[model samples]
Target: MADIRRRKFVAVLGGMTVAWPLVTRAQQPVKKIGFLSVSSPGAHAPFVAAFNEGLKEVGFLEGQNLAVEYAWAEGNFDRLATLAAGLIHNRVDVIAAMSGDVSIRAAIKASSTIPVVFISGSDPVQTGLVASLARPAMSPASA
Candidate 1:
């Protein structure tokens, strides 16, 4: 009887240990990301699909563990600032500014705290995005 009780207790403890991490992970809040682009929806479709695929590869799925808010300037340079501000107002955890330096500049100007990632063809340092290539002086690391 003692051996059977010990075995059961050990099994229960092991099961709980195995399940604890999963429980904690499930309880975690969903991450929110802001995708800011200067191009129209039709032009940005492929990039958006690729971004979603990358996120899925890392175990993040839209409407599940992650939520993405897309803000497009629709090729209007004047609207970039407003769109970036809207993303900040939505309380996005991170901003992905795509297309060019204008989108990145808008996102940076919108918020000083929120991290901004940019995809620019020009040199980031020369574009005033970061202080240096090694240690970026901005919100967070840009890639």
Candidate 2:
């Protein structure tokens, strides 16, 4: 059974690999990713580098296919809302809330259509950002 499951998984993965480019080609080119941070740019540079490295591992390169727009609050929580709004105005395809719950909340309140991906220290499900870890709630774009 385990071998059969593995074969099925490999088959699905191979199919997805062949279909991935076609799916992406049907969508908008130059995908935009919004980055929201509570720290200053200087302080978050290493984090940004790590993020870029991760993206590179997935075959994505900045300025070529993926475009990243950064918004830093510089320890000022109040600025996060405005930054989120600016990213929404720019129509970013997805928002990466790099800070804590504050940045995540700001991004959630900013727009419903754009999908928000957050890395938080707190429990996202308990905080009501998601229904569960296994299956996230759909954004307005998906709806």
Candidate 3:
């Protein structure tokens, strides 16, 4: 009877040891990212798909461990700032500014602290997005 009880206890302890990490991971909060764009959803469908694929490559999946909040200006340049502000209000971990420098600027303006990742055709240095490409002043290392 003593041996049987010891065996059962050992088995339960082993099971819990194997499952503990998974349980803790599940209890951890999901990461949230804001997708801010100056174009319509339909127009930027391919870009969004690519972005999601990139996220998957980096071990992040939408609605799984990560949540994406999308804000589109629908070609209205004047609405970029408002949309960016809305994303900031949503409390995203980071803002992905898509479409152009305008969207990037809007996201940067929305929150000074929140990190903004941008896709721009123009020179970011000339646009004042970064001090230099080799040493981006926005990063802590440069600061």
Candidate 4:
């Protein structure tokens, strides 16, 4: 869980940095980030809180500089694809997929343009999510 939390923190920070320049240039509305998880919101509150705190530390406040759209599967792996589709339909700038490989793969399938940061217990490279742990593939959907 700690590893998951740390990955979430780093992913959000990277996403925000990538979006910052474009956001300032366009002067658009609050940037939107999509959070896709396999667990219920109630059960995943601590993980979400930790991620939010990390964002705050880097000067990005939710509802101020950014807005997050959360989708939970309630432990149902089948629902991940649907939830990921919804985030893509909403046109979120980035997606943080946490929980496991199922959620991550669902997000990967959902959008190629949106950046996806995934957390998984299994080996992502072996699963073909990336080329390797050290040098990941540069896909449009990959963060």
Candidate 5:
């Protein structure tokens, strides 16, 4: 009887685990957001927290109402290119960049189609990351 009970419990657990993916897939949202920051974790802590909190306030929570992919360059300007390429490969709906002009430029170079939201100290237009902020369209070569 003990063996039989254990077998049934195991069977049920297996079934539930198998079904979980289908159930989750059925409810998953289509939109995905990728956030890239050039600053290190130590530098962007408050900004990251505030960004998450803002989303939470707007009825969106990380991994719940929406999906987010975060990449931090950690103040290394060179990593921005690699990070931007990674985000592009992930095919995120949009990218939010928190670095300086370098990151913004990288994001623009990574993909022209993927919309990028940049919070940078430098001028995005002058850097050619965007044709204009009002109509922010990125081209391939913006260096």
Candidate 6:
């Protein structure tokens, strides 16, 4: 019985491998990511620079290699929608829209196809930013 199960598993795995290329080819290309925040350009410059440094540590760089878009609201929650919409319009791969629940909601409302990562202080699930705290929907970056 074990041998039969093992054979079946191997067959399924082999079939999946054979079908992988077809699915991979249908996938889209690499995308630019957008960072939406209310921090002033100067206020967030260091953080951005730090992020670039971290990326470089892992073999990535901005402008020369990676593309990053910034949509700063300059300290106003009301402006989040406009900035988030702009990122969605740009077809950004993802939006790193860190604020509270409101900002996350704004970004999500602006676009569904493009992924959004919301960094918040409270229980993400309770705030409804995530479906559940333990097993919320996640992307590679957010995961």
Backbone atom clashes (below 3 Å) for every candidate: 0, 0, 0, 0, 0, 0
Q: Note the residue pairs that clash in candidate 3.
A: none
Q: TM-scores of all models?
A: 0.78, 0.73, 0.84, 0.73, 0.71, 0.67
> Deviation in angstroms for 18 in model 3?
2.5
Encode model 5's per-residue lDDT on 1-143: one tens digit a residue: 99999999999999999999999976878577888888877888898899889888987777776788888987778889899899999989998877677777777778778888877576767766667878767743473
Top candidate when judged by TM-score against the true structure: 3
- Give one digit per residue, the lDDT tens place, for model 2 in 1-143: 99999999999999999999888865747889999988899988899999999998997788777999999999999998999999999989999998687788788888867888877677777777777789876333322
Cα-based lDDT for every prediction: 0.88, 0.85, 0.86, 0.84, 0.81, 0.74
Task: Provide the RMSD of all predictions against the true structure, rounded to 1 decimal.
Answer: 4.5, 12.4, 3.6, 16.9, 6.4, 12.2
- The stretch of ten residues in a row with the least summed lDDT in candidate 6 is 134-143
Off by over 4 Å in 2: 1-28, 138-143
TM-score of 5: 0.71
Question: On residues 31-109, what C-alpha lDDT tens digit does candidate 1 reach at each position?
Answer: 9999999898899899999999999999999997999999988889999899999999999999999998888888888
Candidate 6 at 20: error in angstroms? 27
Q: Residue 115 of candidate 3: its Cα lDDT? A: 91
Candidate 4 ranges with C-alpha deviation above 4 Å: 1-29, 138-143
Q: How close is candidate 3 to the true structure, as a TM-score?
A: 0.84
Q: What C-alpha root-mean-square deviation, in Å, does candidate 2 show against the real structure?
A: 12.4
Write the residue-wise lDDT of candidate 6 on 7-45 in tens digits: 999999999999898778545354587888876678878
How far residue 65's Cα lies from its native spot in candidate 5, in Å, is 2.1
Better model by lDDT: candidate 1 vs candidate 2 = 1
Error of 1 at 86 (Å): 0.8
